[model samples]
Target: MEEVYGFEMSDGTGDFFGYTADHLFADIWTRPGLTDRDRRLLLIGMLAGQGAADVLGIQVPAAYANGELDDEALREIVIFVCHYAGWPQGARLNSIVEETIAKAARRAARAGESS
Candidate 1:
């Protein structure tokens, strides 16, 4: 984040970024024909092209928490992108997806057991 955006992202700075991110996203990414999940996946694709799988991977949960994604759907998106985006990119994203999925599944499992 500091490398790309030049901001030291503490909670205060991040709050400002969040506000701007929300407005900017509501304008462009949420344009006609795109849902928030679509916008998130699109952003992920673009970021992937720039070799930013770490951020992309981390954003998956945020997207889900923000009501932009579901796990099964994300699985398909990753596989579909793998076909069009090539093996190296696919391999990189695969690690991200696997890690994200495992984290989500673990969280879900823990919640279920506690319930």
Candidate 2:
């Protein structure tokens, strides 16, 4: 699998990223039960419900970049989630999704300019 996303764990983080690499990514993500697209959708919903914005900041863009989701689909998910997860959480996720999409656009524009 391609390494589409990554982050540096801080010095005193006690092997957090290492364990994530060894266990979460290397093991769980490699499991055959779900395709990457399926995993992304599941993760997006779970994170949105739990109001995990920081992780969403990473995942939302990755999902878009990898074609796991699009703006309309994400918008629909946000709307659906609002009824269950509350309006505030949905609103927060909307902002995070908007920011992620905007950043993706900027990156694409820069890549176009250089090409």
Provide TM-scores for the models: 0.67, 0.80
Against the true structure, whose TM-score is highest? 2
Provide the overall lDDT of each model, using Cα atoms, as 2-decimal numbers. Answer: 0.67, 0.80
Query: Which TM-score value belongs to model 1?
Result: 0.67
List the RMSD of every prediction in angstroms: 5.8, 2.9
lDDT of 2 by residue, 1-115 (tens): 2454533434534577678767888888889989887888788888988999888888887788778789888888789878888998899889988887788789989999999
Candidate 1, 28-97: lDDT as tens digits: 6556997666667787777666667877766665665565667776677678777777767767776777
Predicted structure 2, TM vs. truth: 0.80
Off by over 4 Å in 1: 1-10, 14-19, 29-33
